[model samples]
Target: MGVTLKDVAAAAGVSRSTASRALSGSALIAAETRALVEDAARRLGYRPNRAASALRSRQSHLIGLVVGNLVNASFHTIAEVVQRRAAAEDYQMMLSITDADPRREEGILRTLGEHGVDGVILIGTGSNAAASNALLSGGTAVVNLIRGAAESAAPTVLASDRDGAGDATRHLLELGHRRIGYIGGPPGTNSGDERFAGYEQAWRDHGLPLDERLIERGPFEPSFGSDATGRLLARVPEMTALFAANHEAVFGVLPALVAAGVRVPDDLSLVCYEDISWLRWWQPPVTVVDNGARELGELAMDLLLQQLERGRGSVPQARNGRTYRVGAQLVQRESSARPRDV
Candidate 1:
């Protein structure tokens, strides 16, 4: 038979009430007594019953993490960070991947809600407004990460996409590149819009001519990256440098640059918005922004826990909405330099 609370109290020489309070993590229990009871419980192989605890406390202590795309490194990092943070507070985490599909996201959110998740953190999911909307109204507190241009009532946390991209653009300008090109995510997507806005802001700040011919925006695919680089090079031969929208595109852009006889920092400088592994040790370590995905995850969890602890009404909402902003840092590296002519 499994050891019960009675066995634990008997082993610890404490009353059943004291043992129950200690096992339930009641603050009223003295630390020494709590430790003694916990130690005795361990020695006696006594496991607390989760169902009984949940029934009494009305807390399942489970947080659901929803990622739009599992293949993306940033999302994976966020999930890892969130899981760690949740565990620190004695809460368990469950992860669900949506593959950027709004329908899938909606279904997963409903399932998690039905399964008694205390809260949820949603990573970017393209333009899935309905999913977010349902989550907000469905009585579950939710948080968003890396999402821009979305009308969300949830308390959101994300890296500053505009400022990060602006920093990258300004870096190229400082390197004396007059004719810069840009390869980016699909237009209208939240991330794509904000990042591209940053690219535009840099040019307006410097009074540099915004050349449409030197720009290409498309899906964040390696094939698009490789093909876009070729097309941009062909159409705008004088372009001295390029900024890729994300890490996945860089995977394709780098190889295309090599095939086109483009020497990094010498023939054509290149940078990407999202930092990834291959960008770390390439012949030219690509200069890029660290989007602080992990930090955002940690903060997102904190926000969710706040909702869980204080209740949804205490989180507050506003005309502009509530958000927590995490900053992104630009890691300058060998891939970027002054244009050959400059």
Candidate 2:
């Protein structure tokens, strides 16, 4: 049987009331008495029941972490950080996955509220604002990760897509590649739109005409990337380079290139976002835009704790909303080279 408070009290020769105070750090006990209780707890290997403690305090100290699309390695990296951060602060996590759908996010939030999570940390784009509003209405603190545009005034932490995309575009432009193609993420996702806008802005800044025929949008699936790549190649046969929005999208594009017998870097060079573990280990090392995902998660949890302590009283600066933008950097690799003719 597990050691209990009664065992600890008995071993310490102290009253139950005194033992509880010593263990919970609630009331201040004498130094001698506290020492005795600590010694007894250590000797007896006493473990306090967290559920019981939560019930007595009416505070779970548990954050509901609802993530969308765990298939994306970056999200998993963020989750690892969140779990560690929550534990460091003497809190727990109630995790959920919504798989990139707004309706599912609504259901997950409702379930988390019913189960009594202290706060919620959402990691995705385009969740139900009504559902999040409902969570706040019930006095639950919320934070968003990897989401730039949101309806709620709640704090959000997003990857810096605009500048990262522009950097990628500039790299290609400097390589003397005039015909560049882009494959973007889902339409409603803020990151997708911002990245697409950045791509366009880079072209304009370089005095290069925007080619509507070279752009395509789809789900961030490998198959969609392959299809988009094939379509872009057909429409703009002279295009010498491609910029895909993500690693998964690149997965699709690479296979399509292989099937068509298109030589990489020689026929077409590629720059993509995200470098998964296996990616760098593969044949041609892929050049990519790597945002600090673990840092993003840690910052989001920090913001959630801050918002919870603040209790919606103060308005955050910048667009009159609570939001955070995590910066990203481009990783150059062997997959991209100077244009064939150059």
Candidate 3:
């Protein structure tokens, strides 16, 4: 049999991670351990044909990357990062979108399996945990970006959804607006729930009562935001400020408000969850929670590389699950202000 990573590990009396780091030329490995691993490889007549090793291990060096709700510009940021990272690691990424549908996620994953992807990176708003668990059980190396899968399955790169939401809500509350409306993303998404939780927590902390009628669920799409804005306006016509869950939703809400002759900030203030590029150049601009999209994407790629190295030659325990969280920042722009009646 050809020499394997385990063979080198055994010969060098070092862990597989040590062996991988040594071979991959990472700076983190100890000099002595690196020398030992190299000596063992030479002694064992081990020539690492990366292509062959990948094939023998049933890893195609192709990772199936699934994204949901691409309408959110955040996904576009993530796609760029993932592709760049994949290229750096000499791997190929296959991209697909599910539009946040569970059935579609399943279908796409099944196709990925047929096409021989060794791993997957699922990026979305964290709903299909059950389906993600199924993928884990099938021996596909899976990582989650801005979403969470089963706790026992893969590592997650999560953005600070709660912090961002709380900041948005607190901004409005501090502006002396008591009658604030919240337009959130779909019920199935963890980002939506976590953000709404932050909204509630902010209100409770400030001794403000949360009116159920003031909260509305809209999918992560501009059209849904428009529809939800209309419904909330009809229910509570006197609402002075709105906290929208995402940039796309903000786009929807802003146009509707303008069409209704509602002066932004002067009449109805808006705080949204993300910083899309066009927001800076918009007529009135936008005050939003920056969700650290680029950082989240970069760190996610790092975590995926870690998994690939750690889980290369042996089974990993469930306790090895990892998470890297990036915090949120609130960017002040022109769209939010003190209430008109204040």
Candidate 3 clash total? 0
RMSD of each: 2.9, 3.1, 8.1
What Cα-based lDDT does every candidate model obtain?
A: 0.81, 0.80, 0.81
Segments of candidate 3 deviating more than 4 angstroms: 1-57, 124-139, 150-152, 311-320
lDDT of 1 by residue, 1-342 (tens): 899999999999999999999987899999999999999988888888887777786667888888766556787788888888889889898988877677887788788877767788877564655565565566577887776325666766767888999999999999899888999887777668878999999999999879999888887678889999999999998989999876567778888998989888888888887677777888878888888877887788878888767665422355434777889899999999999797
- Residue-level error in angstroms, candidate 1, position 144: 1.3
Worst 10 residues of 3 by lDDT: 311-320
**Per-residue alpha-carbon lDDT of model 3 for 5-51, expressed as tens digits?**
88998999999878988987779998888999999999998777767
The residue ranges of model 1 lying beyond 4 angstroms of the native Cα positions read: 1-3, 10-16, 30-32, 126-138, 259-261, 314-320
Report the alpha-carbon TM-score of model 2 versus the true structure: 0.87
* Ten residues in sequence with the least summed lDDT for candidate 2: 312-321
Kindly list the per-residue Cα lDDT of model 2 for residues 7-107, writing each as its tens digit.
99999999988998987665589878888999999999898887897788766788988877666778788878888888887778877887777788888
